[model samples]
Target chain A: MKRLLLFVPSLLLAAFAFGQKAYLEDPDNFDPTQPTKILVDIKQCDCQRLLGAPEVFLWTWEPAELPASDPNNNGSWTSSNPALAMTNEGDDVWSFTFTPTDFYGVGADAVYSTGFSFLVKAKDGSGLGGGGCDEDKTENLSIKPELPEVPVLVVAGFPSNLLPQDVFTLVYDNSQEEKVSMQNLSADEVYCYASAFVDSVEYEVTPFFQVPNNAALQMQSSGDGTFTLMFIPEQFFTNVPTGSTITSMRFVVRKKVYLGTADQVDDPLLVPVGCP
Target chain B: MKITLKYFFILLMAAPLFTACVEDDTPDIGEEGSKLDGINATWRLVEVNQQDDVSFTLETRNISDFLLADGNAPQITFNSADKTYSVDAKGKLNFWGTEGSWTFDDDVAPTNITLSPTGESDILVNLTATIRPVDKFLQIEFSRDCGGTSIITYLYKYERAN
Candidate 1:
């Protein structure tokens, strides 16, 4: 009996050393006294036996004592936000990219620590299964244990502008992560951006900052009271004009609304001039 | 000693429970719900009998010589003032109004359609049709014996194009 107790400590020590980092932390270790923002990559781990697509439910909690923690775990953590969790195409892998809502020191004056753990559930409630279609029940059905540490950080500044267009593109050392796309551009707004996606499937919506045309523009109304976007191309163009400055041949000149979902065009309007 | 033996026996019995945890977690596959019912809307005749068959009368000469056309040039415009026009859900192209007495037998193969005129049967055509959203063209034929025993067929095709 004494030897068994002696072996338990060594077994625990070995387990702790080999275990993966299962908590959230600010990777940059920013000050928690100010508003801190960190982008988390909640990726799918390969530990699941079935084709498991991981969906996360995030919360802030006080860490419970080990072994005494609730087993059929009810909500112990305070919920923050919910978002659509997507998966990597080739595998059963999925990920959630999110930042905490009140990263700024909204609740306190001093640095504090709290537990943030995501309760992950399989998209299909049937947990990972054994090999083959014939098996009824084989393996012990228990939550596969994994944990991620949540690090608190101090926020440095308010957004210089609260406009929805303000965005930060994180270019990492290798730049392997997916780039988010900017969306819903309006008329007369100009933007410039250079970006590439981590995966080809996500390339369609990669976001970026807008660059406006150099020449200031104004709306010039026609006799029919329909206005056209007018720009003095001479000031903006450094190269010879290959295309007409007057948008007569292009979509901007006609101001056509192609219909589908507002995002895509199914059948374009074909009204003749002054038809409407 | 007796208690330890019982615990060992329990663990041994439970070993089978933990041996192969494979459960068929596959989701149930069901047939996709019935293909959305084909919509009934005004369709124009594209060809009276066969496409590009000029033997079909009322074929226009202005179009491509190979293309067969219609004579009446009938265009179905929704009477914007009519209360039924606003209630159409199939979009302006394929929808009908509230008070629509429309029924279609698209469930049967090679569906047949009939139009029942509202209030006045001869002057205006109100339809309950089995037309698919595809096949935007409809042909209506009327045969009459004219000029002393000569049977003349009036063939007209309406094509759907805005």
Candidate 2:
């Protein structure tokens, strides 16, 4: 009888560990004091009751407890307020944007020290599954506080997260270039050698040397030592076979005319492609 | 005397036939006002409702105050005489472009209006009512379809501005 009790608890723990996951939209720039969007994937959660709910709300009690003075927190497990509702991001993923300091009515120091602990759930979380405690809710999720830091050179534009068919822009800041040879490069002479891994096989989409037909691969100057290249992967990589999945892409920026090895700017950037 | 009585009964029966044939009062097609007449004026967006078609739930949000505060609300004008429409979005939320020509699927009681924006393909927009002037309201619903299934719908409600 004692062994049966021990086995049941262990099974529940295993299920909870493998359930839902959460990701920050901009993890590299995560700052507790600034507004940030957090995405939660509830595809594997035991919340069958929330599958097609018109709205979902965040229920949090960790990092710092919800203050009674906070207007958005209604302080009821059975009824969640609409002010804390999350935006549906399709495909069972939901996102909530909030600044830690203002959301919890707490100081930045407390937020940085404690981080976040929360769960996605329906407004009315009654009679949901897992013996009522787990119904219409995702497993407890947490995010450790990390100070925001400026990236060395490249940063993604618009949708920081990318899908294969989406139009993505890679912004290159010449001022932040770390390599001594690539620093202070002129924006007007910038070009990119683009390639993609289709179904795990590498295929060059643009030639390393400037060609008449590869003019589209040239990065456009956005002024102030910044350059950007925006293209749709499915459209830009014409060599990729149709119906084949693009797993990731690689880019190496350089001058139009390569002068030995010093003309290449920065290291090759490899970006993983996300599922549609 | 018998022949005179029989003629009186026949005349009484014929009186009912004359009443039925007295020219029906129903108006002809062109004589009645066209549906375009009600939709010819300017309209200002007041509210937007997003509906989850799969869930069959609607979430309504009033944006009239927001638009007023921003001072850039989208206003659309329809010209019934020329079958043309113009939108003054002022760089705001607008589905239709700056100018377009509109036509109804059925002129008498149109359920949809096909808007052909300048240099753009035709877009069929569903109408909530056969826009009449007395209604003082216009509601248009459109859906975003993914893989042949409509995932969500947006209902834009507008009030007659001019």
Candidate 3:
């Protein structure tokens, strides 16, 4: 019996580490004939999953900044209806569906493409009160573009389910031959800050920029550049429940823009939320 | 055989007493100044090396025009005993006249210690001090923000207040 108990925990850990199912599909070859759509499916057997996952996910649009009404409706396909409740689909497959909106936004036309990703978790039975799950856990799905594709930029990695609270480290690498500039947007949450690579440089602005919560380091590209940005929680949103452990984090890096211009409003690119 | 077994049982039961006595006799093995717990105490930001040979005061109040415009001062607190410190986590450590968190990298007894700001890559202050029994004074070199060393040096002295 004692051996069985140990076995159960080991199995549970293995399951947690490799427990969830996640994938993204965008029809094949940018199919111009059909509306460009990015589809996502994630599910977990664990019971204590986080509730009220963020629905609105945004990413940097090409050409950097865009008008308030995105000129090119990058063929969005995600529905903004509502988060669906988990159903017992056979042997415990708690699932959800995601449809990505057009790149140009609500309406417009173009190849409408930019690189982005997602953060997800296995549903443990905490908030639901099933009592048979672990709630404080997180996972991520990082998507990158290969050669011939435009550079895959990293925005901000923040917590979506502001439960217990969270800390994150974002690594920015400027391996490209050309120099690149970066910025962060914490979605108007003060105290959310980003600390760019260690101490080589410092970038501070009045009214913290909307990049990541902890972004302070800035630099012109040194050859083959790499930077690690860290995100530490200084406080929480009003909606977050007290005593709830942060399960995961989410945020975006609006597209990078030249600092010399007055037109700096750019589309923030999305990435899977991460927890460190 | 039964007597021998009884004696074995008694010895086994008394083993803990012997071990306890031995442990009591052992001395705490630690180096001269390597003990963090002994040196643990509250430290305030005494002074910092700033531009134009100016010695910047470390206040836990919002005093900057920009910070006041934004509302708040750059305040820093150092509690070495607890191994924790606080800086403006909003990526605005510079507004408080410093960068990131403060680190007590190494503590050398008799007068030398290395401290650096948290989240910074370059070295900030390499302090050489005169460690008196009660009055400790140190000469500090500050790093320039715009790619050069501070022409002037800032000195700070502390007494065992706590």
Candidate 4:
């Protein structure tokens, strides 16, 4: 019995050191807060089972206690936000990217992830799984895990903004995970923006900001990972010169960490406005 | 106090009864509704049936050719007071409604209608139409016998744009 206990700890310690879904290969390239992409190359599970693409659920929480804290394992390991779901990129490789703002709801005085964990459930939920060690760290908290592999950010929803006459609407591909798009736009009274799926994370993104154009924005969550965005165009561009037309106006999701300190999440939603 | 309570109870009991008694005695429109009530409202093209085989009794010259062009579905709004119709495409009224007059013909299934432009009297000869009114739609057939060689028929369907 004593030998088995000692052997288990050794095995767990090894898993902790080498077990990571994937790491941010280049966290310095783009805004880390945005729905950034990370090419997560998944390594073989300790279980030695032939791995397939699994539905990854990210569990982020403020460190408070150990396994003894949430003994029932109800709230701690619960699956609520599908925003962290991952996509399998064939050849035993997978991709997981999203705006942490969409998942973590922390603000200026917010607590960063004292600990974050990924629960890779089989796409079938067929009683098979892979996560942290089966040790007492259940109550332990971590800001980041030291898994062997590194993961990048993945995003969803590519929009084609084809607004006809009076009615304006956007369509996106919905056959993916926690997909988010920022392409819904409208032209009404003031320069407004309709950003969708905003998170209360510090240094995150707002719907729209003053970028030369007289722009304002509003957002409402819509069906199947979609957001309806309405925007106002610059008055000058509104009635552009006969031959001139406005195009490729971008709005991103970012949060304000401080007065001059803020960052964006994931990718930006591109739209076209102005000139008839 | 007792009287107030009794009146309050009576008012509550009578409220629903009075509400149910309210009725829309303003008369009901026909199952298909009236087409002339909105004679001046904007009408938009929804469907067209252009057949090149019919009688050439009234001069016909392919109106579908002018309509169903590249972009923007065509629409026409008639000004009852001025007796002039305005045609708009892509929100701009610069296409075809050049001071035209319209009159309703007496009928049932296929309502016979006439469209005559003031200056172009020749167009008035071929613009007379027998329209089928179906639930906010006016389906008109522009047919010509082609003087015996071949008959051409073009069906243009329009709906309320507003």
Candidate 5:
């Protein structure tokens, strides 16, 4: 009677376990056109067979259409999506990083209506999708360019270098002024200031120029996004004696320009003013 | 969500793990007295080499003695970024005087720097000082051809300010 009582409870427990169906936790909305989409998810409903399983394996296919029917076999898998299989991360969550090309991007011109899909199985031979009933899809479809590259600021023309003369003669109209233009410069955020070296101290020569609202900047009509700053030193000296020779000078575009030469992008050209 | 809990537990375990590994091994990128940054600082006269009528040799004296103990500290502040250099010179070093524009020769590497008066006060002459940036200081060699072989070579040693 004691043995029968234990056996009856075991039979009832076995009957209750057979009703739990295995299924994949699929993403509700998935677009197949993003350049790069990475996901880490996927849990099995009935994972009792995979108990203590060290890792799980995933079979993925990309740039390929969804299979017509549910696949119950494992031999029909390819590694087109860069990853042939993925081990379970934890909590049944898996990792999937799609190739930038597999998605239907605007630049691709080729439409891949159906994105990549993959099936999962435990390394211990346990079926992932409802015990082999469904497949999982990724999210996001972007038709845009792969990704924008970082912009680089290019400085051209002058921090107009070269010391032409010893005395900075205020020619009736021509004073030694440097014209420095920047390419691909976003002037809205980057404020430019002119810097000159007199003795050993670096003075903000930006005030000497007739700039836009005390901001030394003037954008050119070159559609290529170029900005220029004219640094003319009329009252270039402050509290100094007369007939002072101007030494080297350069232009910098950044916030808090005087926070020292560090963390600032300065034009490489130097104005070597000559003594006439 | 299960994911949030997993990451939270992971962050908990990782919090202490990473705390012990927190060590900033970044290289010191301070470029003191190199390139243009070399001359960008207040130059205080620290040492001097007084030139006599003898050979190219001159008398050596710290700035304390060169200024005749006058406490009227003679200093040529090269605020180069503003294109202005102020000078409060006294005694034999009367030429620097007040303010001026200090320039350096660039055709070659900048070893020659010229100090020209900026304000109405005209400098006796356009003083061109030779600059040599040592590891932590800028050594300016100013020479005046008083007459013939009686050239005065004033070696002005300057220490950099922060």
Candidate 6:
């Protein structure tokens, strides 16, 4: 009887510790200082009581230094606070979106060093029995956030990320042009051939040379070999069918009179669209 | 009796002069014709420039042809008589509404105009107007701020349609 009791608890602890996993939704563009959604999969965990629970909460203590809005409040193991509740993302997956620096009440340095340590649990923790995995809760989970690298400024999008409805601005630094034929091009000579991909269907605007409108494809000059094109994706690409979702955009800057491939500033650049 | 009669005659003559010297308190209606006359005609959008407030970067584009290609060139008519303005943007531009009331900050040498969209009196948009006496071109500039810092400025250039 004693051996069976010990084995049962050991199996429960092992299931709780190894079955749960956490990851960021948008890992490619994850920035520790920005708001990001962390998803926790508890389908494989032994937390039966939490799988169908109406509400789940996040319990974190990684940074050691807690924010003023910390839901733990030193230690509230028995009471699940509403502020710590995790959003249910269906199929036994829970999500919590927060800016690490803001949520932890710490600086970027602290977040980079400590990362995040958390676990998903039910609101009623009375069944936990003082730190023991006796109830519906995952074992301690940790995430080491990686920051994205800063670009050197060949082209940059204002606001970094964009949605279809946003007033998007694509800035081109002419000084960084590598092609010999594209160098020292005047503002009036520079134009962009742009296209928006909606539902995998490409919808291109008028070509630079064949533009029916006068200088419609020409980029605006800001002096010092810098140019910009600003427009709302949905408004600028009028041919896009109604109610279609824009997935991404592609464009290439070239001379107004395309003599050859050498007239192009660079290869076509692709920009991914993000959800609002 | 002869000396008193002479003094009273002198006083009566000076009273008329004093009354004539008094300045008229009524406002000047600009006898040379109101400044609003220059902007009263219907104007169509010709060009638009978006300038960054921080870097002073500019993006200028001729939008008149694009507007025409879309079959709707955005136009606005300013009625000086009723102090009202109407816009026919055809959903191309979002700066102005269908109709609104307008007023110049200084009626004599006005540099700025305030527009109040219909049914939205609390929301006001102030635009700097550049209108020359002989030029048919009109330029209105406005700034958009984010987090209490001016970020971008929109300059709309228009030409007299009528």
Candidate 4's residue-wise lDDT over A56-170, tens digit each?
4333343222232332221334332344455767765556575443334432112232333333433233232354333211222223422223232222211122111111222
What's the lDDT for residue B144 in model 5? Answer: 47
Write one digit per residue (lDDT tens) for candidate 4, span B1-162.
999999999999999989898986887664653345445567788665434231111222233323455556878775555556766655331223355776655423325456676666412212233332334665555433323332334456678665
lDDT of each: 0.28, 0.72, 0.34, 0.40, 0.43, 0.72
Q: A185, model 4: CA deviation in Å? A: 18
TM-score, second chain, candidate 2: 0.70
Question: For residues B127-152, what per-residue lDDT tens digits would candidate 5 score against the true structure?
Answer: 23433344356676654443333234
- What's the CA error at residue A164 for candidate 3, in Å? 4.9
Task: Name the lDDT value of residue B21 in candidate 2.
Answer: 83
Instruction: Please tell me which model should have the higher lDDT, number 4 or number 5.
Output: 5
Q: Which stretches of candidate 1 lie over 4 Å from their true place?
A: A1-26, A31-95, A101-111, A124-276, B1-162
What is the iRMS for every candidate structure? 35.2, 13.6, 20.3, 27.6, 27.0, 10.4
Q: What are the chain B TM-scores of all models? A: 0.30, 0.70, 0.35, 0.51, 0.57, 0.66
Candidate 5 docking DockQ: 0.01
> Which regions of candidate 5 are displaced past 4 Å?
A1-276, B1-34, B56-63, B66-72, B90-92, B119-135, B147-150
Candidate 1: interface RMSD in Å? 35.2
Expressed as tens digits, the lDDT of each residue in A1-276 for candidate 3 is 999999999999877544534322332343323343333233442322533343322222332333535443222223211232323333323333322233323211122333334333322213333233343222334333221333455333322211122233343443421223333322231122222211233222212354433234232222334433433332322233444333333332222332332223133323222122
> Ten residues in a row with the worst lDDT in model 6 chain A?
A66-75
lDDT by residue for model 2 (B62-107), tens: 3344244465567888898999999997655456778989998988
lDDT value, residue A8 of candidate 5: 100
Rank order (by lDDT, best first): 2, 6, 5, 4, 3, 1
* Pairs of residues at least 3 apart in sequence or in different chains that clash in candidate 2: A128-A135, A129-A135
**lDDT digits (tens) for residues A1-276 of candidate 5:** 999999999999867543322211222322333424333344333323443445545443433433434331233432222233554557645544444344222212222322334444443332344334332322212222222232332543321122322112110100111233222334353345555666665666446223335533433223334434432343433423456655655554443223444423444434544321
Model 5's CAPRI class?
incorrect
Q: Write the per-residue lDDT of candidate 6 for residues A1-276, one digit (tens) a residue.
A: 999999999999878654658877777887767898988888665455566777788888876646546554334666666777899888888899988767777656566567788877776675656655676678778877675554566666664444565466777888998778888888688788888998689998985556425465688887889988877788888888999978888878877778878877666878776542
Scoring model 2 with DockQ, what do you get?
A: 0.01
Q: After superposition, how far is residue B82 of candidate 3 from its true place, in Å?
A: 15
Worst 10 residues of 2 chain A by lDDT: A153-162
